[model samples]
Target: MAIPTIRVGLTAATRTMAGTSAVPKYSDKENGIIATDRETGEKLYTVMIFLMEEDRAETLKVTVPANGLPNGLKPGMPVKTVDLVARPWANLFNGQISSGVAYRVSALELDSGE
Candidate 1:
């Protein structure tokens, strides 16, 4: 039986926009083409966010849907993550192992503290 990978939910006490929310995500670095979500066939966007926990805050480059972010979002605006999940992936490239955590967000909305 194949073991299904469990997706861990991610949250933060506070999140703020760090950059433009409409930035396109590129899959091919050389070609400079925008990436897309395979399952839903939607264009992908990369958003810069700062997640604050306790006394620390770290910036994260998160992948989100092109249309998932509501308009009027700008840097320093307080936001909340919707249905956030993180998955770890690793692969061998040219005899070297490369690994990273990929975060997916269903949507980003103004923080209502709900």
Candidate 2:
């Protein structure tokens, strides 16, 4: 089944690079559980973005291609994401349900204005 992506806007949301880019929680080299792109087989990295909206504020951990993230991203620096999207995921494992919304972005840029 093809999952639909929901576009996310940062127009009224103030954002910042929360911390250094890191691998996903399931990424563990020792256990051979490294996370890779399902389509390209390329590795993936997660970026923490601090977002403040009108009624809600939370840090979003958005995934991006290993080579997609820009270099020299400083924490607390004003930033914006291009082609931001969210995908709802749910899986049944061990008779348990794991579900959440996953966020992704094509590019992350240091906001020069607005």
The alpha-carbon deviation from the true structure for residue 94 of candidate 1, after best TM-score superposition, in angstroms, is 1.5
Please, what is the whole-model Cα lDDT of each candidate in the order they appear?
0.75, 0.77
Residue pairs of candidate 1 with colliding backbone atoms: none
Candidate 2, 1-114: lDDT as tens digits: 678899986665455555655555457768877587878887787888887767777888988877676777767766778788999999999999999999988778777665
Alpha-carbon runs more than 4 Å astray in model 2: 22-28, 54-56
lDDT of 1 by residue, 1-114 (tens): 442244644454455554655588888968998899987888899888888777888777778897788788787777877776776788998999998888778788877556
Q: Model 2, residue 6: what's the lDDT?
A: 96
Model 2 / residue 45 / CA error / Å: 0.4
Q: Give the Å shift of residue 68 in candidate 2.
A: 1.9
Using alpha carbons, what is the TM-score of model 1?
0.80
